[model samples]
Target: MNVFVSLLRTGVPALGGWLVALAARHGLHIDGDAVAGVLTPTAVFLYYTVFRFAEEHVSPRFGWLLGYARPPEYKALPA
Candidate 1:
């Protein structure tokens, strides 16, 4: 399940690129290169944001699936 989600996250940009190319080929009057330039950053930010949200929200179940190990408890030093 986590692996599938990981693949989906990684696939969004490539899928966006393909969709952009499809639009370009259909007389959409959009520049594929420019669209890809915009999408790259957007995809990266979206990926990170979703990753963090999932890490915080669904972490207990998805944690090990994504190779994240819970950190060992630490004692605070006296101030």
Candidate 2:
């Protein structure tokens, strides 16, 4: 699933956006494409950057917030 759909499915994270979109539709009015084109990348970058910092400085447990229940172990290939 794309980030927008995933965020919606996950709940809370996308709620604000949906609320804004609803308001904009009935009141302000903006193109859906305009919002989606900018929002997806911004959200992806912001979420990853913030959560990655938290995982490094605060606690590894924060990894779950990024969808990893357990951090993946890095393994080097055998030569």
Maximum-lDDT candidate: 2
Q: On residues 20-44, what C-alpha lDDT tens digit does candidate 1 reach at each position?
A: 4555446645776676667656655
Alpha carbon deviation, residue 14, candidate 1 (Å): 10
Q: What lDDT is reached at residue 79 by model 1? A: 100
The per-prediction tally of clashing pairs is 0, 0
Candidate 1 off by > 4 Å: 1-29, 60-79
**Cα TM-score per model:** 0.41, 0.57
Please give the RMSD to the true structure for each candidate, in Å. 8.2, 6.6
What lDDT does each candidate get? 0.53, 0.57
What is the C-alpha lDDT profile of model 2 across 1-79, one tens digit per residue? 3554344434432443455445445553567777665665556566666766888889988766666533455557899
Candidate 1 whole-model C-alpha lDDT, 0 to 1: 0.53
